[model samples]
Target: MSTQAKRATIYFDPDIHKALKIKSLETSRSITDLVNQAVKEALSDDVEDILSFEERKNEPLISYDQMVKKLRKDGRI
Candidate 1:
């Protein structure tokens, strides 16, 4: 455990809690380690999503009516 790690009170559903316990025993890892890794992965995905949005922030915005018109023009609607 890292000395700088903070403590949190998290609640999990009974089924998930049981699964975590089983996984911990099988993998010889702590529940905290598994949860931390999951959280890190989730946050990393969020960061990637945010970066994607930022990259597209200046892209064109098409209105619903305009989209429908284009679809009609292209015989796609």
Candidate 2:
């Protein structure tokens, strides 16, 4: 991992880019900082999701149709 940040070019939809610019100005933060923080948060969420899936890897699988049938049989549907 590099301590220094590397520069990369990313494209955003026109409307989203406009919103980011407005948000950056309103927050008194650079667009770079906001974008980096958003990216970091998203990546963190992904890591958490992966860990949760790994932890639940051995759980049983059930189908939607089976669940509905069971519910109907139990008179709960």
Candidate 3:
């Protein structure tokens, strides 16, 4: 967490807002902290996916039709 924080207005659905308030009281943490953590986790997953795609970028590509045919031939579909 940073000592200095920026403020922003976020509108959450009524049910979600109620859930966050309950979670905040139960965990003794602010809604902002929970939202920030969730955002960070989502961004981290995206970065991992991007890296995986980069690693497989040079692999041979297969079309959907070709894949189904191959699967049928292999008796796996």
Q: Give me the candidate number with maximum TM-score.
A: 3
How well is each residue in 1-77 modelled by candidate 2, as lDDT tens digits?
A: 35887889999999999999999999999899899899899999999999999999999998999899999999997
How big is the positional error of residue 10 in model 2, measured in Å on the Cα after superposition?
1.0
* Candidate 1 lDDT by residue in tens digits, 1-77: 65799989999999999999999999999999999999999999999999999999999999999999999999997
Residue 45: error of model 1 in Å? 0.3
**lDDT to native, each model:** 0.97, 0.93, 0.96
lDDT of 2: 0.93
Instruction: Give the CA lDDT, 0 to 100, for residue 29 in model 1.
Output: 98
Clashing pairs in 1: none
For each candidate in turn, the TM-score is 0.84, 0.81, 0.91
Candidate 2 Cα outliers beyond 4 Å, as residue runs:
none
Say which prediction, candidate 1 or candidate 3, comes out ahead on TM-score: 3
Superposition-based RMSD of candidate 3 using all C-alpha atoms, in angstroms: 1.1
What is the Cα-based TM-score of model 1?
A: 0.84
lDDT of 1 at 13: 100
